[model samples]
Target: MEQPYTLEPYQRCGLASLGLAALRAEYPGLSWHTLGGHFRSSQPFWAAIGANVPGGYEQRGVCSHVTSS
Candidate 1:
């Protein structure tokens, strides 16, 4: 899933669609169901590592532990 989209620059709408299609074609064995499961499980981790932007803040607002929450 991180094969192409991560940190990419802007693109026109048509080319963006084509790029997504190409990415899909390249990963024939990819499973959306498994991907969704992992994504769901990792949401908090992603929030913890959120983008560093102008304000120098990106992490989750609250500390979250998998077992605690």
Candidate 2:
């Protein structure tokens, strides 16, 4: 999944969180994975959503693992 964007006026209103919640509800067993360096600045966000950045190299980047809740 790509980083979610909201208009400047709508930033930090939990819109992205809400959307992710809905997606989880729809796909209960879904898992999210991405390259570690793809969104280097969003590490906190990924962690907040329960994603784990495991140690080790994945291809050319690190591995990001998001297990289903």
Candidate 3:
């Protein structure tokens, strides 16, 4: 399957990190959780980043366990 506006392979980590850091900076001491449904492909990314969040991915309505791949 083709991905739309897919991120470069090497840029994923740095980009995600920066984005999350910016969010944290904007909202200090806020608990971040993964809410709603995640795509089968994006699930891995969500799980990976969710770990660094204040709480491990609080898988609300998500079916799969959010864990680092």
Q: In terms of lDDT, which candidate is strongest? A: 3
- Candidate 3 per-residue C-alpha lDDT over 1-69 given as tens digits, one digit per residue, 9 for 90 to 100: 123233577656556666777878898887544444557877777677667766645356434566555
Q: Kindly list the per-residue Cα lDDT of model 1 for residues 38-65, writing each as its tens digit.
A: 3464454333432321232233333233
Candidate 1 least-lDDT 10 residues:
50-59
- If the candidates were sorted by their lDDT against the true structure, best first, what order would they fall in? 3, 2, 1
Q: Write model 2 residue lDDT over 1-69, tens digit each, in one string.
A: 654557989866767667777877898767554423546655555555544323321324333454444
Return the candidate ranking by TM-score, descending.
2, 3, 1
Residue-pair clashes per candidate, as listed? 0, 0, 0
Instruction: Report residue 15 deviation for candidate 3 (angstroms).
Output: 0.5
* lDDT, model 2: 0.55
TM-score preference between candidates 1 and 3, better one = 3
Better of 1 and 3 by lDDT: 3
